[model samples]
Target: MMADDIISSFPDEILCHILSFLPTKHVVATSVLSKRWKFLWRSLPFFDFHYDGDLFDYDRNNEAYSHFLHSVDSFLLSRDRDEPLHRFRLRSDSTYGHPVSIQRWITPAVSGSVRHLDLCLDWGFVMPSVVFSCKTLVVLKLTFIRVENTFSVDLPLLKILHLNNISSPEGLDLSQLLSGCPNLEDLEVKGFISTTKGKFITLPKLVRASILEDLLPLEVVKDVEVLFLDSKYQQILDFDFQNLVRLELILQLSKDWLGVLEVLEHCPKLQTLLICIYKSSFDTFLAGHEEVVWSYPQSVPACISSHLKTCSLKYYSGSIDEIQFASYIMGNAKYLRIMKICIDSESHFTFGEKLHMERELSSCMKSSDTCTLSFEYSS
Candidate 1:
């Protein structure tokens, strides 16, 4: 097919898919490609206005940033506000030069039309003073950004919310967010690029959640499918995951594995459990805590998922604590079948010692039927 003819034959949907992978700068530059491509980028269902200083860092005093911001504003302004946006992402590291700078795009993209909203501003500017009551939003991701007092973005139709590195999310209350999002499903608060030092936040209606760093707690949320905890704090978690199915615990062993176990008591059907217990770099935790044994519940609640058949552990060195924990699950998981222990290379276990682990696990199963315990290593 001729180049121009082939471009003309391509469907708008296909064109949008091709454009989504490129940088927004290139997407906009398509306007200069030809008349056929002028409005194609605008028809895209998703907009990721991500600014990478590493790629196009303009001098703070230069006209490039302002010009770029204006171009974004123009595109949003031209779009029909009523048109529902599927995904909208905006992020930067510089303090947004002006408060109004964010509103120029946020105000239009919001308004009960967006289904997936990702609003990230990094360290750039303070957020706009606007309450986005998105009635049709399904997934909402809010990253590092500051907001003035009295701010709320209601997502009545929201299901998944991934909050990463919230800066002074003090004014944002979990109760209001929960009550507003009556249909929320998954909530993940990852402190990847940002950290929190104040009161932890707790939300409502979420079924799966990850609490990392110093994030706040959820006063209430139920029917959870998964739970992940990664933090440096030593506080014992005291929440009840009544119907949780999968649990992932990642933290330094020095912190305390039992604190993580305490959180699992409420789970009635926890099927898959992955414990990445950093073995005190593979020493101090096992030897240091061997005498301090835990007094656990007599019966590990299997109601949440009596169907649990597989288990995996990382950083496993056949430590007494590690084996004891795994044995507790084997005893309670009446239908347990396979348990895989992956010992991290950073561990102190010898090749023969690891082989010994496999032999010991052979007899660890509770039932007459045999369960496989495969011990592996990480590079």
Candidate 2:
């Protein structure tokens, strides 16, 4: 059979499915192949727009940026409006996006029943409120954008939502947004959370949450099974994590070491625990001049004695306080099966010092006979 005959043998649906796997740029380039394929890309249910050049120097590359914007507008507007949009992903570092143009692109996607929408733009303008009310949206991710407080959010079917560096000077009340998304399952928020008088709301379906906000209430994530918390938070661990099975903490050495133990005290069913301690400039200075005291807890937490199974410590400096903390866990965790310590070779400790620290950790009492200790070094 001839090549064109073979190509035209498949139905348009099959051809469109085959074309959807390629990048939209490559897919659009297929338009010149033949009349049958000229508008084949227009029927695709997915739209992905990614600017490929040096987006940092916008002034020097204005023409290219403008061309990219124009291409995005053409691709989005020329698509089959009757087809349901499954996903729309646009990533650009250029901040030249006008609010009207943004609305023009998103309004159709929302109207066409878009399910997943991801926009990672450096544009400083507030997003169109039409996105917040998407009823068919299952996933939404926005970065480097400011969300206004007046937008009424009603994403009833949204399951996974990620908001990175989204701000509102008037203090965006998360409770107001979350109250609308009743079926949300996975959530991640990283940015400044201004004060709001709204009461804490509970999400029964929420399973995993990673929070890097400054002032989020504990009630918002009280029911999550897996949780990640950063050091930037205030009063983050003030409530109990009754359902948390796995926990990850990113902490700085400058904070109170006792707070670590305080967090362990609340997770009664925790099985996997990972802690990464980072050294800041101020921490390095303090480590050089002063000794950080690690006051051992009077009693082992419930999880350590019964449920805790695996633990990881990253950037293990083998300092007096760190060793004390490690020794405490090694000596007490009755169910601990594995403990890994990641050490930095560029740290102040010498080869012999690291060996000594390992020996010290090895000599500690292990409540579980199957427990093993391992060390990894990174330059």
TM-scores of all predicted structures: 0.71, 0.86
Clashing pairs in 2: none
Instruction: Please give the CA lDDT of all the candidate structures.
Output: 0.65, 0.82
lDDT tens digits, residue span 1-379, model 1: 7887787678888888788787676788888877888777666677777654433545653455576687777777665455456778776655435557676667666654667777777555555545346677788788876654434546667788787765544555544445566667887866533332233334455678787755354444445677786736445446666667787878575646566555555565777778776644455634646443566665555441366677788877666667777777666666777777888877666778878887777667564155666777876
lDDT of 2 by residue, 81-108 (tens): 7877898887877657666677678788
TM-score, prediction 1: 0.71
Q: Could you give me the TM-score of model 2 versus the true structure? A: 0.86
Candidate 2 displacement at residue 179 in angstroms:
1.2
Worst 10 residues of 1 by lDDT: 192-201
lDDT of 1: 0.65
Minimum summed lDDT over a 10-residue window in model 2 is located at 192-201
Candidates' RMSD to native: 5.5, 3.5
